[model samples]
Target: MSDPFDLLVIGGGINGAGIARDAAGRGLRVLLCERGDLAEHTSSASTKLIHGGLRYLEQYEFRLVREALAERERLMRLAPHIVWPLRFVLPYDAGLRPAWMLRLGLFLYDHLTRLKTLPGSTSLRLDRDAAGAPLQKRLTRGFAYSDCWVEDSRLVVLNALDAAERGAQIRTRTTVESARRDEGAWTVTLYDSDKRRRESVRARVVVNAAGPWVGETLLRTLSVEARPKVRLVKGSHIVVRRLYEGDQAYILQQPDRRIVFAIPYERDFTLIGTTDVAHEGGPGPVVISAQETRYLCACINRSFERQIGPDDVVWSFSGLRPLYDDDAAANASAVTRDYVLELDTDGPPVLSVFGGKITTYRRLAEHALDRLGPHLPGLKPAWTGTAPLPGGDMDGADFERFLARLVAERPFLPAATARRLARAYGTRLEHLLGDARALSDLGETFGGDLSAREVDYLVRHEWARTPDDILWRRSKLGLRSGRADVARLGRALANPSADPGAQRP
Candidate 1:
């Protein structure tokens, strides 16, 4: 523990985790610390689409859209199990934007990149198309285009897993109490919340990837003076019962000009959301406000034949976006989703990451390392783009084929359980489901298809310390698991030492 780390990344969100993975793979000793579970905030509370931001095109963010579009395909390849193709229907309204303008934007989106696996945008007649059945009769014409859906929280966890695999230290429930530059290196003091102990680590450099708390991390955690450099925008979403029967989703443009997405969720629910409201306070557990809920319901009701009210909302979550304050845009929705990386070379370098979206995290990490390259003499070249994440190196990145093989090997699991495991773990499932011939080997059912075996795997390897981690983050089984089931799982995690094989360290 006395040895100095080459890099210490101070955040467990997508950007921080992605940088740690990239840095570790580049032959640098890395450490990543999070005060809570990974993706427990902005990274998890997303619209859950790996999109090119079709709306941004209106603001002339062509470069951002282009890069995001390219990475959308790369993510599909790099994490096929969690990210997949989704078609979106944008119903035309004469009152909103003219159809000709919509057609032009769609054309630009299609031609933005040279490489794409999805089909081009095409016109749809609501009366003739299955995607149109849920919409009102008045919305007869629309355009359908391509995007990808992601298991947002799992993506963050996978990045940390890959970083850990590449010899980086990932400490969850650890906070950076203070960091100060001394002589030519950074002395970072971390507080282990689990052990209630403090430990100091030496690192050649520090990365402040603390998303919403970027400013606070600088002034309070690192003891540095900085201005109001970031804009805290709050985005919220609502989950309700399944709104439609089809695989397709809808992107409805409201009278306010803000677009809302109503996509299929976790089998039995419809995921509708995302209102961009300005956040004026500190970061914590964000919830959808009454106004946001009403706004979202109104947005959906504009097109869907089935009307909904606030009471229909089964669940809702909110997160704050740490957008770099460019001061050019006034509205939260109009603010750029692009990121800004600041490297302070005043002493031993400390890199600060600000204003980034999930779509471009990989590229951001590469750029981060490139900025710090001068300080670290022997850092290796960029390698994450061509590399596959943990369990992502399947044949042609074909999740369905890999899933079929997994189920074929373990016929004990029900089809639903096997598919869920495959989607969550991919190739990692083989090692997780080790040496069990039937259902009995899985041990202790905790409701749904959640078994003792999966819990052990999550604890031993993936850092599941609570029932909520397993039920909500790693797998969205919380949406289905009953109260009794959750309580039992909670007790199991509370005493990890009870199981002989469960990890203690």
Candidate 2:
């Protein structure tokens, strides 16, 4: 083996990617391995909100809420292109949570964090307000609160990109098959699926941030005999043709005492989610069940003036949340979302992470590094909070001003295409455009405004090897792309030399 790395992170989800970025920025040699494309699982399948869990107040998870609320502000500053403020309307129901209770919860949510970039909560006159136009006539009063929306998967890929730029080796489509401790270090065996080959490397410390597979990675891959503390809770979501005309989202309370969100998505769809059902089966590929589809549809149908059934669901997805099992929750929905980090120092130190949400990922990385500080001496202090991600170096985090400038300079780009590029790449749009003065200069249109130049940029800088990597995660152009577009993209990827913009060393 070559020189041992200071840290080896197993998993490419948000937590893992964040850790790798943090460790690499601290001048430690780091390696991050993922079994599939980055954020292919839970990280990408989030409700995509960067809010303090307003409901967690009922469970008394104050610290988690406070940290998440603060991080929400920091992330907006750090990645202005992909993270922005969102308003949520919570319609009142006399049969459900009392009005005073909702007010109290929103009050705590607004004050929990010191940073206040977004507006505070206020009572809404649903009958008079435009936000109330879509709600059922029976719902006369509601509340409006502030949260932030994120391009979830893109966040993961950007973290990995930043980590790689900071000298961390990010190996996607590579699995850590096994790891063994030898002489105060870990001998890790990785299987690269694309190459169909196995390789071994050494690392002083290993971090297990494998979302749903954390338990299996420890028991099977690492051969650790500790009892797994993770409880698998499956959350599912559905997408349909736009349910409303506004950018605002709705948070609906169900009779079961659980809450669901219906948010405007992708410009043409309304995203409704998230049923928390216990996942009895072991972690693998998960799909939204018929029951879940009905549950979500019913959730929207109950509150919206326009009703929808399962047939209206254009797309659906499910992901398993590996929550830290507190063992006292009455049901899956009640389980604590707080994370627990366990350090096993039997030989080489291995830290296993359990149950963290996307909002608190940065803090989780900081805490993980703090836990490993003793074993790995001379570590730098936390700095991710202040630093910007790869393309988020815009002044004052002013995304709109940056976008206006991009459009002004590249008037050749269609307004929609320019906006999409600015959102996806921020200041990096110049790298992709590269002196192009016309639409044809982008090369090879593949529907959904996706072009050959963009694809090449993704492949070269973002580690995009497949079309799905571009369509779904890198950008949600998949919603607009068809089979023909996918086939064309696949063909383009198959022949790298065909791309005129391919960098020649």
Q: Rate the local accuracy (lDDT) of all candidates.
A: 0.89, 0.92
Residues 32-151, candidate 2, lDDT per residue (tens digit)? 999998999999889999989999999999999999999999999999999989999999988999999999999999998889889999999999999999999999999999999999
Tens digit per residue, CA lDDT, model 1, 162-234: 8888889999999998989886898989999878999999999999999999988987887766674889999
Model 1's alpha-carbon lDDT is 0.89
In model 1, how large is the Cα lDDT of residue 163?
88
Candidate 2: where is the Cα deviation over 4 Å? Answer: 496-505
lDDT of 1 at 402: 94
Stretch of 10 with least lDDT, candidate 2: 496-505
Off by over 4 Å in 1: 498-505
lDDT of 1 at 130: 88
- Top model by lDDT, which number? 2
